[model samples]
Target: MDWIVITVLFFILGLSAILIIGTLVSLPQVGDERKNLIKMKAQSYTFAVAMGYVLIQLFKNIYNGSNEGINPFTFLITISIIYLISLLFFRKKYGS
Candidate 1:
């Protein structure tokens, strides 16, 4: 029942909610070109998220050898935020 644990759970649930909502939303009928563009954007964002995870792991390995002074919860939150922001930005740029 620690506050940190609660916060992390909340963030995880919030992210899950957002993703579920996004998937459930209807896409506009667009031309093939626009659809391709959106697909490319989604792929790029997915790559960004993967890279972010790798970089975060590398950081944790280098700086937290003793596993002190580093909070993994914060890193998870940061990754989630990065993913959400990129998703929103890509959707805005290509979804319209």
Candidate 2:
């Protein structure tokens, strides 16, 4: 695989990590039906966003040059940016 594809994969994985972490951190402490529903919604949204990021990156890799062996920190920063953008756009739509 090209470096660009590798970089995009890194970003997608990082985004997925962020989503899972976010859901874990935000989950309510209480246990009940309401909490269960809330947790499911959070998980669903996180999964959806993560998948979207991966799909988007797959397309981007087609035209971009390979970006092999890029720094993790750089990949993380880009992941954060994409996560924030998705949050901003989806927050209202999902009413989270």
Candidate 3:
């Protein structure tokens, strides 16, 4: 990967981490109903972002004719990171 792409990816990941941490920190102060609503919205947003990222990668691969299949490790890591982040948010909000 190019240096610019890597840099941008890191920037995005950092922003994501900040957002997740901020949400987690604030979740406890909210009421239960509001917290559940926020959790649902957060999960939907995370899913959308992850799907968009994967689709972008797929398109790039098609354009570049890189037959090297998607790395399972990277795919799993991306998904698991998103899952864990949302899980943290849910746990903090709902005590689950």
lDDT of 2 at 1: 58
Task: State residue 2's C-alpha deviation in candidate 1, in Å.
Answer: 0.4
Q: Using TM-score, give the best candidate's number.
A: 1
Alpha-carbon shift of residue 83 in model 1 (angstroms): 2.4
Q: What are the TM-scores, per candidate, against the unseen true structure?
A: 0.51, 0.40, 0.47
Off by over 4 Å in 3: 1-32, 83-96
Compose the digit string of candidate 3's lDDT tens values, residues 5-41.
Answer: 6676666666666766666666655477766776776
Candidate 1: global Cα-lDDT? 0.63
Best by lDDT: 3
> Where does candidate 2 stray beyond 4 Å?
1-31, 65-96
Q: RMSD in angstroms, candidate 1?
A: 4.2
Across residues 5-37, which tens digit of lDDT does each residue of candidate 2 receive?
A: 778777777776777567546545555554456
Candidate 1 per-residue lDDT, tens place, 1-96, comes to 698888867778588658735732533466767655655676588678767777777788788674444455665565556555665566677776
The regions of model 1 sitting more than 4 angstroms off are 1-8, 31-36, 56-60, 67-76
RMSD of each: 4.2, 8.4, 7.2
Clash list (residue pairs), candidate 1: none
Give the Å error, residue 56, model 1: 4.9
Q: Could you tell me which 10 consecutive residues in candidate 2 have the lowest summed lDDT?
A: 87-96
